[model samples]
Target: MRTKETVPEEALFAHHQAAMEISVFGKSMDVLHKEDFLRNEEFCILVKLRYLLDNGIEEYAGINESIQLLKASIEAKDSFVIIDQTESRFRGGKQQQFYQFVEGLLTDFVSTEDFQDRLSQQLRETLTQIKTQEGQVALRNYTEQLQKLAERPLALKLLSLFKSYNLADYSLLRQISELVQQLSKKDVRDYQSLKPLIVANYRTFESLGKIISLPPQRSNPDTFMRMTQVLVLEYKYQLPFVQLANLLMVIKRWYQPYQNIIAVREQYPPHRYEQPPDFQTSIPGEAIFLKYKTWLTEKSTGVLFLDLGN
Candidate 1:
């Protein structure tokens, strides 16, 4: 029996690791592609042009002139050189015509306008597309169900935090649903049994947040260290020592920098800056615990307990 249970647990763990790797890879690729696009002169021109159009700047002459200049710069293999040379020419007492023209084009392109109509149009298009997609209907229904289930005062508070921080995910909703189902199956349940499950669920969200919000500069060990400290403090009394130790080990492994720490430190020394104080209550674990406590208190009546926990 032990072996059978352990095998499934190990398999689930492996599956989770694989999913994390895929998520990381997708995020890295997105960052790389964005950097590449930003560096491309054509892409830069189009983005500026899109901004102009979105802002209702349809001056044909200004737009055409700007496009020609950008295209010429691209052909010369140095788009930024035009901006640099134009500035230098102006300072050298040469003709200011080119510099003024380019400057005006850029200035007018970014000038703001009321974008309410454009925003409304975008929303209508999005709604139309969502209505056409069959899967989106199901997704919307699921979201509605989640919102309803989250209406309990305790759950509402936690849900609001999760939404505010972009911490909520489909997996979290699924986990909550499963927990509720398990509780329903029990012949007798109480605060003690439910408390551990809530803690476990919150811990999962904390772990996911740490993984998803990993610093771009992985050489910075401070984030991982802070995560370790919080996890240890939060779970030390609540969980078995062995389990806590294993969780810490997992965090340490995930936090390993892609680059060597020695090399990174040598390249970038510490700066003399005042660091912000760490707020312990802001951590998901503490917030979730407090909300759960509030929920327990609010539903303390024996009848409420009998319906849900008994």
Candidate 2:
């Protein structure tokens, strides 16, 4: 629960503890590797050094020198982490690469007690660069595929619907995964309202002998949404559908913030909406921009307002 700014030493000390479970910079480290922590000799060295640093002991195995190596990042002739204080979002800085650098620190430490101890002077300076910069473009990029998908029309449409496409979560797919609920609706509209139509049609089809009678379904909006999607499959070029909570598994089997969102969804299942009169592909962006909002900076300019949402 520590804010990024105030989370330095507590995070270090927390990692030092034996539970081997803690969150660092918004990412959780589970104790699945707890057994390994007790046996890893290399990890003991690093973590013990961290313990000394945090307690202000001013010594590591009494050597009074930094044993921590700058092995990850290499420069032209030698290896070193980039110490750019000014490189950040919107400044053409490699914020994504920097995030990976910080992520690498946690990744290495966790695999090793599976974790840490102290905020050393150099560490304090390094952690300063790290905490405020997590998942900054939604902590950005998944790979080359992310770059390709991010520039596509479909990615824009999906992001438009989800609303919280972070410049922090860079990978196009993880951004999509985080907001998968929005895509699961089956309303043939945003996919939330399908029960009445399917129920009505089921009875009608049965009465007309177009289909045989069967036991009632364990009825719910979710069921209705799936049942009505076949219609949209037939809609073809005019695909207007929502798959209400279809990918709830991917959403629920995640870590925090997401677990919080899932808890809320459980407390209140997807809300019901009237079945749309007809399927129509949703127009992207705020209607006000399309229908009313005008160009800014100058009223006389004829440019329409654009909602290039994340």
Candidate 3:
């Protein structure tokens, strides 16, 4: 049995940093493309609640009372009640439950003022790094666009929340929650707006790839290449099945040129061809030559179609 290898702390930290950068870029793209400000509003509320709870604000207790009222309203439902009232009760119950859950999380995870301060500092440092990174011009531009969009009252609430809680951390969690909701909704039109962002992100990765090193025998390069290709296909085409089928077709075409070489080896068997070829003066000898060629025809045929300008 193969044992699991332990990663060095430095390598682990590097990996984490890379993943965090990618995540920031991805969330910025979502904010640019989705145009759903309600998510930001909800996030601001949650952060504010966390701040109030941490600081022992007296008004925060009113939220618990409000939740109790909502629960009572839900329980008071009767057949005589209109459908709209019942629906409102149901939504109220859900909202109360969500607030309670978030409150519990804040109490458990971010209980101390010192820890909250540290988290806020880390978030600020991370954002500053992202903004100042010389190679991340596109990401910087996207961040500017997000700031412009969030200039309204709802965004002002976000700023107020950030004054206490951590904006980057809260935004990351909010984006994750919203992404889950988006998946359930299956709205392709919103995703269509992400095409340019995806392409720009890919270009950013491509530039990073030039400076990164990998073992020559390892498959990491090909794996990352395929992942980028799939992202382009999924976002650009807006149809997963069609793009995936085309990807498989590309793999098949890549393997086609080597099939005859494999067939010849199988037919002759390895033992028969194990003898070294002899080159001598005045001797005519039988020789078998294996040649493999790959054509750009597959690429020309447009297996991966993308218009980055779009």
**Candidate 1 local lDDT, 105-217, one digit each (tens):** 32232221212233233334444444345433433343333333233323323333333455534354345334544543442212233444545565443433432333244
What are the lDDT scores of the predictions, listed in order? Answer: 0.32, 0.28, 0.31
> Tens-digit lDDT track for model 2 on 1-310?
4322222344334323311221221121121223343353333333333334334353223211111100000000010001122234324234444434443443243221122221122233444454455423222322222233233423322222222222222232222222222333432433345455545444322221111111234233343343234223223212111221111122122223323323333343323322222112222222222222231112565532222221
Q: RMSD, each candidate, Å?
A: 30.9, 30.9, 26.1
**lDDT (10s digit) by residue, model 3, range 1-310:** 5443443455345434434443443343333332222234322233233334334354443233222222222222221122223223434333334323323333344323433443344334444444334423433332333233233323323323332343222323233223333433333323344444335444333322222221223223333332233233333334433433343243333333223323333443434333112111111110100110111112454322211111
Where model 3 places Cα greater than 4 Å from the true spot, the runs are 1-97, 102-233, 245-261, 264-310
Q: What is the lDDT of residue 128 in candidate 3?
A: 47
Better of 2 and 3 by lDDT: 3
Question: Which 10 residues in a row give candidate 2 its minimum summed lDDT?
Answer: 70-79
The TM-score between candidate 2 and the true structure equals: 0.16
lDDT of 1: 0.32
Which regions of candidate 1 deviate over 4 angstroms? 1-122, 125-163, 195-202, 205-310
Clashes of 3: 0
lDDT of 2 at 15: 24
